[model samples]
Every structure is written in C-alpha cells, then in structure tokens.
Target: MNPVIHFEMPYEDRERMAAFYRSAFGWQTQMLGPEMGNYVLATTTETETGDRGPTQPGAINGGFYGKHPDWPAQHPSVVIGVDDIRAAMEKVSASGGQVLGEPMEIPGVGHYVSFMDPEGNRVSMLQPLPRG
Candidate 1:
C-alpha cells in the first residue's frame, strides 16, 4: 500500500504558525523564502539526515504553506508517496477523484500534485527523488 509520507496545512501567518508549533510541540520550523513560495517546513521528529524525514517509521514530517485566496480547499492534508506520478494520477482519476492539475517538480524534493478525493478532501501525492 502507498504510505503517507508528509502532511500540509495552510497558515495565514507563517511566523505565528511556526512559533506555535515550535513552542507547543517542539517542532523545528524552517521558513523558506518567496522563491520557494514562503513554505514553512516542520520537522516533528528526529530525521535520518537532517531534513530527509523522520527516522522513526510511520512518523512523518510536514509543512505549512501561506494561504491564498485563489487556492481551493486549503485544509490539513496528508501526502501519499507513489512510485510513478503519472500512474497515480490516472488511478486517482479512475477512482472518481479529481487531479487538480499537472504535477510540478519541487526542487530537491520531487514531483508533487494535489487532488480532491470523492469526499471533497484535498490531498497530495509525491514521487520522491531516490535517496542517495
């Protein structure tokens, strides 16, 4: 089965959100600049290689993105890791889910895309670059 590898949530104030998570949960937050869309990466647990991901199995990392008025369904969502993005997109479409748009490559991360499930929940999928 495909596994959830990450999560995402929209935030109106990136600094406030990061501070809250850091203070309450001891999560490490790294704020990316505008070139990267001002995303905030949250490391919830010890990672294998600094920013690679959680070392503990089943424990995932996540990020917070600035909420945009034009974005649809900006809610908390999990990202599923898939081997082949195109195949996954087709599968999602065949299963009655709507793939929002073409997949986009995240520099040093991987190919990512969002979709709306049948239940109207927005989720994402990622095809990660092979770990070195």
Candidate 2:
C-alpha cells in the first residue's frame, strides 16, 4: 500500500516548518499539484547510503511537512496504498474502524478518506493514481 503517513504539528506555517526541518535535518519541501493548496512534500538523504531504493525507481521516500495539512488536526490521516479504496474501506469497517468523510478527489493525485481505527486511533489513508 502507498500509505502516506503524516506527522501532526501545530502552526500552519509551511515556511517556518521548512526552516526548522532544513536546519535540523537539511531537508526541503517541493510544492506539488495545481493550486498548490497546502501541498508540500519533503525530501532528504542524510544517513549512510544503504541499498537506496525508491518505491518506484526514481520515487523518493521520507516526506516532511512544515505547515497546515489539508485535513484537520483531529483527523490526522496516514495513507495506505491499496488496489481498491472501496475494498480497503470495507476492510476498515469490518475491522471496527469508522469512515469519517466522503471519499474525495485530490484532482491529479487520487482519492482519500479519514477514519478511526477500532481502537479509536485517528488516521487517514490515500490512494494516489498511477501515472498515465
């Protein structure tokens, strides 16, 4: 699954958030998507080089955030890549999780939803569409 797990923090300041991360870890965010509304992905290569593999070759991992997320703080969501959102959601329900919002589109990205796990962990999931 392409799970987009997020770290929740106060302050909707992406720039300051960027600076903090940049200083602490030497990483940066690259704005993505149309509107660029709250969409920022972080990248870095700090540790000793291991096997160095991208999920999809050139695909970079370890994203960061230094601003407000599109979703609310209580609804903090971490996405899991799945072949089927409907099926995955169904599994979420069967597993005692409650779906919170309507499945929404990220325009060019894909679909997403917020849900609470059986244990009441506020989390979210995303399914990014494949490149044409």
Candidate 3:
C-alpha cells in the first residue's frame, strides 16, 4: 500500500516555530534559505542521509512552510508517496479530486503536487527519486 510519507504545516515566524518544536518535542529543525521558499525541515528521527523520512518504523517526519496569503486550504497537510505521479494525478481527478497545479520538482526529493480530496481536504503527493 502507498504510505503517508511526509507532512507540512504553515508557519509565520520561522525561528519561533522552530524553537518551540525543538524545546518542547526535542525535534531537530533545519531552516532552508529563501531560494527554497524559506522552508523549515523538521527532523524527528535520526537519518543516514539527513532526508525528511524517519529511519525507524512507525514514525513519520514533517516540515514547515511560511504562510502564503493567496494559498487556499493552507492548513496542515500530509503527503502520500506514489510510484507514478502523473497516473496518480489522473486517478485523483477521476476519483473526484482536484489537482491544485502542475507538479514541481523538490531538488533531491522528487516531483510533487497538491490536491483536494473528494471531501475537500487538501493533501499532497510525492514521487520520490530512486535511491542509488
């Protein structure tokens, strides 16, 4: 079965949010620069390559994004991993979901796109790059 691999939440003050998570939950945070949309990567578990996913089973890691005024359904969202993103997009559409926009590359990650499910909940899908 496809997995819920990653998650995202909106943040206004990057530093404050990072500090709160770090202090309260002991989660590590890496703040990405402006070119990467000032995204904050939260590492909840140890990693070999420092990617987002947790190294241990039964655990999941997520990230934080700066809030955008124009974005709709800007609430917390979970990202599901898919083998074929294009085909998944078609299936989502066929199943009464709306693909938000064209897929975008996430550098070392993979192609990703957000969508609204039939119940109107916003979620994302990612096609992870093959590991070498």
Model 3 C-alpha lDDT versus the unseen true structure? 0.92
Per-residue lDDT for 32-127 in model 3, tens only?
999889999888877658454567986778899999999989899999999999999999999999999999999998999999999989999999
Any runs in candidate 3 off by more than 4 Å, and if so which? 50-52
lDDT order of candidates, best first? 1, 3, 2
lDDT of 1: 0.95
Greater lDDT among 1 and 3 belongs to 1
What candidate 2 gets wrong by more than 4 Å, as runs, is: 1-10, 32-36, 45-77
Residue-pair clashes per candidate: 0, 10, 0
User: Over all chains combined, what TM-score does candidate 3 have?
Assistant: 0.95
| 25-128: candidate 1 lDDT, tens digit per residue | 99999999998899999999899863667889899999999999999999999999999999999999999999999999999999999999999999999999
- Model 1: number of clashes? 0
Candidate 2 per-residue lDDT, tens place, 1-132, comes to 354433333336666776887799777566555464455666554333442324354344444333434644443345566667887888999988898778888676678776888777767666667755
Give residue 105's lDDT in candidate 1 (0 to 100): 95
